[model samples]
Target: MDLFIRYILIGIGNGAVYAALALALVLIYRTTGLLNLAQGEMALFSAYLSWWFTTHGVPIGLAIAFSILLSMIGGAVIERVLIRPVTAPGKSHLNVLIVMLGMFLAINAISQLLFSTDAEPMPKPWPSVSSPGDPVGRSARLLDIGNTSISWAVGALALTLIGLCLFLYLLLQKTKLGLALRAVASNPASARMVGINTSAMLMVGWALAAGIGALAGSMVAADRGSVSPGLMTVVLVYAFAAAALGGFDSPVGAVVGGMIVAIAESLTIGYVDALSTIELVVPFALILLVLLVRPTGLFGRRVVERV
Candidate 1:
């Protein structure tokens, strides 16, 4: 039971990381109706920037802030220069998807050329420079009287995710920019007709998504104690699964779905011996199961198509 609890805490932190990226995916989907396959790579690019800044005598806080800002600009530029070429009314969605695939290859190649494939340990941004240097279980403090205990890092991450979610919710609910984003998402043509700059809003959507992706990358790198060009490869799978489980178009669903997926993965790794080696497959299987039962996802709205 203690083991289970420990794994749950660790998984929760990981889930928050996945939730961050999944939120990015949800944002792009809501605005452009396309999945940005390049999200992880974009995150990797930004993380590399952060790592570079940190190595160049910059403060960690400033490094992260600068990295996020750069990523936002990169996202907006990509949307304008690359994505816009393939995106047109009544055009082929396949083309836009392919463009993103091209972007994935392009970014990966650029990273490899500039910053070799060698991975480096990412120093912690805060005082906790070293992981407690113990097994994740032993590193956590036991509860006074119960079998449950908490991991400090996990607790911190969960709190951060909650705060971010609340902020996003409030932003969407109370801000004019958020309203315009929603309008762009719900009906681009109408939004354009109403003097809303749909194209710019789409750019903003991508920029926001990229910024969120950068944050996710930074957290994952800190959690793992390293940064690599491929750092986001595995995490992206879990993020996609979380997005699918929650509802690709719903932010609240992303958070709930991320936590559920995290818990399920923890339980599976703890209880299913055969899954020990192929643990990563667990989330995909669950996503398949969920989609089989509810094609629209757990929190997705049903859509009717007219031919």
Candidate 2:
């Protein structure tokens, strides 16, 4: 039972990371009706920025903040300069997709060229606590439960996820900007007729998505203790699976789906010896099952359009 609880906690930790990425995916999908294949690469670039800052003696928290800000600006610029031109109403979706794919490859190459292909260790923002005798500090563990322990890093991440979720909920449900964004997303023509700046809202959506991706990437890199050009590839796959499983249009669905995926992956690897080598298959299988049973996703609404 203790072991099970430990695995569950660990799964939740991993799920938090997936949820962050899935949220970004859902944000982009909601606003543009398209997926940014380069989202993960954008995140990878932000992670590298954070690492670079830390290596230059900047505090980890400050470094992450700076990275997020830069990522948001970069996202806006990309949307304005690259994505916006190709994503006009009459433009082909394939063009935007191709651009995103090209960005994926370009960003990966840029990271390799600038930061090198070598993996670099990232310092944990929160300190770990190892034992009862350990002093409470940045390195101290949060708590010890039964035979298992939760480190400060995991605890901080969990808290951060909770905070982010609440902030998003409020933003989407209560803010004027959120309402405008939703209006634009629902019907750009009508939104523009009503005086909403659809283009600016689209830019905001991209910027917000990129900022969230930066956070997710930083957390993942910190957890793994290293960052590299391809750091986000596997994570990107899991995030896609989570977003699909939860209903690409639902933020709550994304979080729930991410948790489900992580828990399933954890249990499969921990108990199913034969599947240990292929644990990544678990998320994809879940995605297939969800699609077959409910194409709109577990929490996604079924859209009805008149012919």
Candidate 3:
């Protein structure tokens, strides 16, 4: 029983990371109506930035903050310089996909070129046992109960996910800027007529998504005690599954979907011997299941078009 409980906690930690990234995906999809295939790579670069900051003597928290800030700026710049031209109103949305796919490869290659593919240890905020050579482990316990213990890493992940949920709720539901963003998302022509700068709102949306990705990327790398150019690749897959399962338009659903997917993966991995060599298939299967059964997902709003 303790072992099962421990596995559940581990799944929650991984789920928190997935929820963070899925939140970013849903945010962008909601605000800009574009799915960024390169979102993970953008986050990979941010993780590298945090790692670089740490290597330069910056504290872990502050380093993550810096990474978020820079990633926000970078996101805005990318939107203005690369994405804007393709995503202009009346343009083919297919261009958006093509550009994002290109960015997927480009950003990964750039991060590797700039930082090298070598994986490096990242400093953790919570107490952890990690060495220079092997930088990730669940060593410090946050809670102990009989034979089951929760690690600080897991606690941090849960807290961060909760905090992110609150922050996003406040930002998107309670603030003027968020209201304007929502307006733009709903209809840019209507929003522009109301004196909102649709382009600026779009840029803000990208910036916000990138900043969230920065947090997700940094925390995942920190928890693992490693950051690398390809750090978010596999994690991105799970995140996508979470987003799809929860509904791409629903942030809350993303969180729930992440937890569901993670728990399912954990249980299957723990008890199913046949999946030993193909664990990643768990998320892919979920994705297929969700798509086939409920395309809009649990919380996603369905789109109705006049034919």
Candidate 4:
């Protein structure tokens, strides 16, 4: 029981990052009606920028801020330069999908070319840094119960998740910009007819999603104590599973789905001897099971079209 509880606690932090990425996925899906397969690579590149900035004497806070800002700008630029042209009315969306898939490879390769494949320590932006001589986990230990404990790093990640949830809720539910975003997401043609800038909204959506991914990716790198070109690879898989389980169009569902996936991964790996070596399968299995019952996911709105 203690072991189970410990695993759950550990999983929560990882789940939070997955939730953040899943939120990004949902955002793009809702706004553009498309899945950006290169999301993980984009995030990895953004996180790498933060790492690079820190190495060049920038404060951690400033580095993260810069990363988020740059990612948003880059996302907007990508939409304008690459996505908009392909997404033009009556244009074949197949090309855009291909572009995204191509980006997945291109971005990863670019990351490697720009910043080798070497892994380096990522500075913590949440809590104080650990001493050089201290054991890796010692400085991060935050909560303890007998032989079980949760680290400060993990707790910080959880706090970040809470912050993101609140930010998203307020932005999507209470602001004018958010209203425009929602309007566009719901019906781009209607929004365009009503004088809303549908193209601009779509750009904003990509920018926002990219910014979220940057923040999540940076925090995840800090938590893992390392930054590398392939940092978000496996996490991306879990994130996609989370998005699928929650509903690609629901932010709240993304968070819930991420937590569920992480916890499932933890408990399954911890207790099931057979699964210990194949942890990645847990998320997909859960996805398949959930999808089998609810094709639109737990919170996804079912769309009915006239045939």
Candidate 5:
């Protein structure tokens, strides 16, 4: 029973991290009508930036902050220089997606040149809690469960997710900027007539998405005790699946989707022997099933063309 509780906690933590990044994908989709296939790469690049900062004697927290700020700016710049030109009002959105793919390639090549593809150990916030041999065994870290034994990482991840979700909700529901952003997303021409800069709003939207992606990357890498170019590969796919399952238009949906995916993955591993060996494929199959059944996703808005 205690072991089962531990697994549930761990699964929840993993779900929160997945949800964090998935929320970013949903944000871009909601605001720009483009699904950024390169969102994972962007997050991975930001994690590299944080690692670079830490390697240069900067504190981990400060490094994370700096990376987030820079990633936010990078996102805005990419939108202005690359995506904006390709996407115009009353035009097909396919070009924008293609440009994002091109941006993905450019970023990946640049990262390879700068950081190399080799995996490196990421600095952890709590490295002393566990050692090579302990009473609980190698599979479990020394988590504070009041003699019950729980995964500490899971608690931290859940708190982070809750805090971030609250922050986003406040930003969107209780601020003037959020109102303007919503207006622009709903109808750019209409928003422009009301004195809102639609282009600026789009840039801000992308910037926030990228910044959140950075946080997601940092959290996952730190928890795993390493950072690598390939780390985002699996996580990103899971995140996208979460977003699709939740309904792209609803941030709440993304969060729920993430939790569902994480639980599903955990259950599959725990119950099915064959799936235990190929865990990553589960999300891919689930995503295909969801898309085939719902098409617009669970929370995606239905579009109706007017003749």
Candidate 6:
């Protein structure tokens, strides 16, 4: 039972990171109607930027903040300069998809060129020790139940996820920008006709997604204790699976899906020795099962069209 609890806690900690990235995916899908295959790469680039900043004597928290800001601007610029042109009305979605694919590859190459292929450590934002004489100094324990211990790092991640969700909820629910974003997402032509700048909303969506991705990348890198060009690769896969399982269009679904995926992966690794060697396949298997069972996803609404 203690072992089970420990694994569960570990899964939740990992799932929180997945949830952050999944939220970014949901944000982009909601506004742009496209799955950005480069989202993880964009995050990787931002993580590199954060590492660079830290290496240059900047504080870790400030470095992460700066990176997120830069990522937001970069995301908006990419949308305006590259995506917007190709995404004009009646244009082929394939073109945009190809562009994103190209971006994924290009960004990976650029990161390697700019930051080198070597991995670098990322400083943690939270203090390592809760108090003096604590045995687990790097990650202070938040709770101890039986033999299971929950760390401050995990708590921090969970709080960050909750805070992000609340902020997004309020932004989408209460703000004028939120209404405009929803309008554009629902019907771009109608939104434009109503004087909404659909293009700007799309850009904002991309910017927000990128910013969120930066935060996710930083947190994940901190947890892993290193940053590299391939930092977000496996994470991206898991996040995609989570987003798909929860409903790509549903923010709530993303969080729930991330937790579910993490828990499932943890359980499989802990209890099923045969599958441990191929643990990476766990997320893809879940994606396949979800697709087969519910094509629209757990929280996704089925589209209804009139001929």
Candidate 1 similarity to native, TM-score = 0.91
Q: In candidate 5, what are the lDDT values of residues 33-128, reduced to their tens digit?
A: 778889988998998888888888887778888999999999999889888887876767777778878877777777777986887667654323
lDDT of 6 by residue, 3-95 (tens): 898788888888998999999999999999999999999999999999899988998899999999999999999989889989887999999
lDDT of 5 at 214: 90
Residue ranges of candidate 3 with Cα displaced over 4 Å: 129-139
Q: What stretches of model 1 exceed 4 Å from their correct place?
A: 129-149, 305-307
Candidate with the larger TM-score of 3 and 5? 3
Question: Please, what are the lDDT tens digits per residue for candidate 2 over residues 140-168?
Answer: 56789877887776787788789889989
Q: What RMSD does each model have against the real structure?
A: 3.1, 2.9, 2.0, 1.9, 3.4, 2.7
Cα miss at 34, model 3 (Å)?
0.8
Preferred candidate (lDDT higher): 4 or 6:
6
Once fitted onto the true fold, the runs of candidate 4 whose alpha carbons sit more than 4 angstroms away are 133-139, 145-147
What would the per-residue lDDT of candidate 4 be over residues 114-164, giving only the tens digit for each residue? 976898777888655466664222235777888887778888889888998
Q: What alpha-carbon RMSD in Å does predicted model 3 have with respect to the real structure?
A: 2.0
lDDT of 4: 0.88
- State TM-scores per candidate: 0.91, 0.94, 0.94, 0.95, 0.89, 0.94
Pairs in steric clash, model 6: none
Better of 1 and 3 by lDDT: 3
